[model samples]
Target: MTELDRLASDFGNAETAIALTGAGISAPSGIPTFRGDDGVWKRFDEGQFTYGRFRSDPAGFWADRLELHREMFGGEFEPNAAHDALAALARDGHLDAILTQNTDGLHRDAAFVGDDSPADGITDAADATILELHGNARRVRCTDCGNRTEAEPIFDRAADGERPPTCDCGGVYKPDVVLFGEQLPGAVIQRARSLARESDVFLAIGSSLAVEPAASLPRLAASSGATVGIVNLESTPCDGVADVVCREDVTEVLPRLRDLAASG
Candidate 1:
């Protein structure tokens, strides 16, 4: 049998398969990643996304971010075949949950991919649980009162003229995403750890496996004896330990897995 066929056989028997995804998974949807040549890093320095920078120039920082998010939404980026495939796998009881390192909310959006397009099974979308490691961009939080609000109008008006908006508590309203040098929320860390602890199969999709804390999670699952698989355009640090390594376009392989699950 082919490697993919063999993977399907193994996947079919897994009790709880959990996915760890990174920016690569969202690239197909037109979201730019932070690293690599011509990435956000090359265009803007790393200091741009830090809390210290935001604190010093909150208006400028937020204005830039708001513009980017507005472009992301207006770019008309939709879920690709890979996203639909993962949703399909999740629906068939193969994937227990998807733990994503992305803050773009693509997986959350991808979970509902078939709600509009009836090609993939619509029933499985509801059963999928997306565990976002980084916080989402669709929400804004008040730094003082912790009151949260939707990011639509906040971003919309900001894109037009509202430079920096404040919350009712007189605190700056920031995107709910975890910024550089900021600690991941304790609750989110706990949830990711719990999911890794319970998984029988751990899959890493499109991540370089270099970032801290979130990068440590797949290792935690591996130490606990969970089968680890990686799919990325290039090799990663933990490549030596992965059971299955496929250096191919995620959009190409993910659809096959989804189609297999849908057929079964």
Candidate 2:
């Protein structure tokens, strides 16, 4: 059988599957991966453009990163097949959880039929419980008081026309994403660890296993005796360790898995 077919069959037999996704999964939908040739890390100077720099000059941080956020928001990107398929699997009860390293929030959006509505027939969209190891870009938080707020309310402010926004506590507001120098969210890390420990099958899709903490989740699952599968365009750090490694497009693999889950 083909690699996708094998994955589908194995996934069907598994009791609980957890998927971990990174930027490669989002690339087909127009998002860029970091550290790749055309990635953000290569394009920008990490010293001046990250959370550490923000700590030095809040104004400059707002000036540089806010515009990037606004541009991304205005871009015509949508959830690609891979993202939709993952949500479909979760909705159909094949996937126990989704652990994403992406800040794009596409996975969450795909799960919802509407903002107010739960997933169509799925029990609770919220319960599917996507743990974003990296923070989300769909919202903003104040660096000063840790206030989480809606991004829509202040999208214009993040754009060039006005002075930057501040928290209720009078500190600079920034996107909810974890910047280069910032650490991953502790709550998310805990949730991911729990899911990894409980999973029967762990699927690592579109990740190179290059980043820390997030890269460790698959290892946790594997070490805990879960069947580990990896699907990526390129070889990953975990390639030698994974039970099954498919060097293919995530868009192709995820849809097949979703289809298999539906049939089961």
Q: Number of clashing residue pairs in every model?
A: 0, 0
The ten-residue window of minimal lDDT in model 1 covers 114-123
**Model 1 spans > 4 angstroms off:** 70-74, 113-126, 262-264
lDDT of 2: 0.75
lDDT of 2 at 178: 79
> What are the RMSDs of all candidates, in order?
4.8, 3.8
Question: Model 2 TM-score?
Answer: 0.88
lDDT of 1 by residue, 1-264 (tens): 666666666678788788888988989888888788847767666677688877889888887787567655557676787777887788787887887777676776777632122111112346666766777777777777777677887887677776678886788888887888787777667767877777778888999999866678778888888888888999999887777898999999888866765555
* Residue pairs in clash, model 2: none
lDDT of 2 at 70: 54
Error of 2 at 217 (Å): 1.5
- Cα lDDT tens digits, model 2, 131-223, are 677777777777677777777666667564444677678877777777878877666677788888888889999988888876788889899
